[model samples]
Target: MKTCNNCGAQVEDVAKFCPECGFKFGSIAEPRAVVTDMYDHTSEFSPEDIANNKLYAILMYCVSLMGIIIGLLAAGDSPYVRFHIKQSLKLFICEVILGLITGALFWTVIVGIVGGIAIVVLAVVDIICLVNACKGLAKEPPIVCKIGFLK
Candidate 1:
């Protein structure tokens, strides 16, 4: 039996979720490649750096512009925080550009549809970056990783 991390419910080892709280335990067969990609940067930084600057790194995504400023001011020397700040800054710039393009083309209904979809994509990328920061990993976020900004 395995204990559910979400609600402390006991479940069978083969179970994919917590029956009591609906928390996803995930499948044991999930691909290792996906997991590895997300945490591939774990060995790049010292645990001390990740532990000490995690909050500032998370802040970089939580508040965008202000978070960048705060992260730089409070944890300027932390490579982990710096990595996240650069990633978050790229996301911020992408959002700004998307918003401007959408606003300028709002008169066309097509722009609304395309903009809405783009916004969702950007949100997902932002979540990925935020999660990586919270996990103290410097994994570059998908899509955002290709953007050439804040380098």
Candidate 2:
């Protein structure tokens, strides 16, 4: 028997994923390279660029469209800030569209529930993007990455 690291549950040694949390184990488990790749964008910008513009990048996520404008004016030359601004822009647009849809369909209970959940998810993604900016990384946010308008 072995303990699953993810959920702290006991499992058979031969099992590939934890029964309690579905966490992959051993050789089949998620690879370090893939995990690193998911957040790796340091090579795209210089260290100085990341350091200088990280604050403006973070602001873009915190203040929505207004933050994007601030970031553009403050750190327009920084590739690092620009990257985060694009991610923030994508999220802002999605939020606007979701809000409009939910408002129009406010009469339906199902739309209200689903829209509320989606809004929560977008908020979480915004936090993720803000954290990435704080870390000086340019990782594209999940779900919002699929938006093709701003790229």
Candidate 3:
């Protein structure tokens, strides 16, 4: 078995992506071809793989924004898990920015409504992500896969 670089999980040699991390098996230390055409973005997740990592995927959504760290340090043993975690990571960044904005808004009680709205919006987003993860879907929100900076 080959070890996955992202989650350090052992994977079969014939696998392309890590069963836990979704990262290309052999390219652990190497950067991924993140900019490949959408048509070429094939990381077929088998039902067995999805079944194996479902819990990790759900944890990625339920653990607040820290789920991203959990994904990096622990989960991410499957492509489906990695996809959701990456999306959650991007959302966490947005959450941080929104939090800073919300903190500023708190000074003005009237305008602080925006903070509440942001909270609600993030919660809804989180729920949606959680559902998808539970389904073992590797489908990503637009921005998650679009950001090619991540190797």
- The models' CA-based lDDT, in order, is 0.82, 0.85, 0.69
Scored by lDDT, model 2 comes in at 0.85
> What lDDT would candidate 1 get against the real structure?
0.82
Per-residue CA lDDT of model 2 for 77-107, tens digit only, reads 8788888877888899899999999999978
Query: Against the true structure, whose lDDT is highest?
Result: 2
Q: Which sections of candidate 1 miss by over 4 Å?
A: 1-40, 148-151
- When sorted by lDDT, best at the front, the candidate numbers are 2, 1, 3
Q: Residue 147 lDDT in model 3?
A: 52
Q: What TM-scores do the predictions have? A: 0.70, 0.73, 0.57
Cα misplacement distance, residue 63 of candidate 3 (Å): 0.6
Cα deviation in Å at residue 58, candidate 2?
0.8
Q: After the best TM-score superposition of candidate 3, give how far the Cα of residue 48 lies from its true spot, in angstroms.
A: 2.3
Best candidate, TM-score-wise? 2
Query: Compared with the true structure, what per-residue lDDT tens digits does model 3 show for residues 1-151?
Result: 7777788898887889876768875555557767755622225777887787777778878995566667666755667667666677776776777788888778787657888786777778778767877766665544434555342
Where in model 2 is the C-alpha error above 4 Å?
1-40
